[model samples]
Target: MNILIAGATGKTGARLTRQLDEAGHHPVAMVRESSDTSVLPHGVETRQADLTDLADDVCEGADVVVFAAGSGGDTSEEMTDKVDRDGAKALIDRAKAKGVSRFVMLSSIGAGDPDPESDLAHYLEAKHAADEHLKASGLDYVIVRPVALTEEDGQRDMTIGDGVDPEGKAHRGDVAAVLARAVDDDLLLNRVVELESR
Candidate 1:
């Protein structure tokens, strides 16, 4: 399987690329031209493309796409909307255009119902919009909403459901493992699952 990771330079994306490699799958790191790819695993393939205006050919041979891109903490809400919402939607459209089979979105725990009064409400709103778009895209998709991310090693034991505590934490590696699993799991097709460490 040729797995394309949109934010392959990020912590979770980097971890995911390596996990996919370990699982004997090809991990294609799709990154911005300005992104530093030195952190990616050896022998991993790379494609230069920005999420905001991705070209259709970027996904030409991809079997699956994992949208892990984001506008990071320092960016404005507009940037969030552009990347997390619009950029994600663009990736979905491109995936379908390129005959990609599955899409796994790395969303946040509160993205299902964003809180208007929270400090991160804008980010959550952007993620909610992207999630909604993916749900309606008529493609095989899995929305993985993980709780607060921790740097601890992956335990590989996680609780999956909507009612899980939003405040619960999960290791980035564990989230990456789940994303890797979703890529080939037929049971996860069209499923929207929230993840948290047990």
Candidate 2:
């Protein structure tokens, strides 16, 4: 399958890239020029472009678009919107324009919450807005809102289900494996699922 991985340089996205590479899928890594591209191993297609401008042809002929991009850590709502909301929106718009079949978003657990008053609320708000937008865009999309992230070393052996507390925490590698599997599964289609490690 042809896949476009946005923010492929991030932790989860990086692991997904490796998995996709091993699975023999055509993985296209969409990265910003200034962002580090060292994480994603060799043999994947690398396209340097900013999400704000969201250059086209990135996802053309692609079957899936995995939006795993984000602007790290506490910041203004403006920055949050730019990288999380507008960034995801730009990829979605381009995916639709290019006729991509599916879009998967690596979101956060607080996405369904309406209040944005915590230290991380702004980030959650940005992700939630993007999730809402994707759901309303008339496309096949899955939004997985994982719990608080942990930098714990590789845990691809984990599992996820529907009833876990949205307040739990998860390993970054586990989230990466989830994205890796999302390309070929229908477990969360057209739904906003909150995830926790098991």
Candidate number of the best TM-score: 1
User: Where is model 2 more than 4 Å wrong at Cα?
Assistant: 157-159
Error of 1 at 99 (Å): 1.2
lDDT by residue (tens digit), candidate 1, 1-198: 999999999989988999999999999999887898998998899999998788878888999999988899899888998999999999999998888999999999889999999889999999999999988888899999999999775789889875678889989989998999999998888998888987
Residue pairs of candidate 2 with colliding backbone atoms: none
Candidate 2's TM-score reads 0.92
lDDT per residue as tens, model 2, 1-198: 988898898877888888888988988898887878878778678887788787777677789999988887866678788989998988888888888888999988777885657777778788888988898888898887788888864556554656767667788878877777778788767766666776
What range of 10 consecutive residues in model 1 has the weakest lDDT sum? 153-162
The runs of at least 3 residues in candidate 1 whose Cα sits more than 4 Å from the true structure, single-residue gaps closed, are: none
Distance from true position, residue 37, model 1, in Å?
A: 1.0
- The prediction achieving the highest lDDT against the true structure is 1
Residue 66 shift from truth in candidate 2, angstroms: 0.5
Task: State how far residue 128 of model 2 sits from its true place (Å).
Answer: 1.1
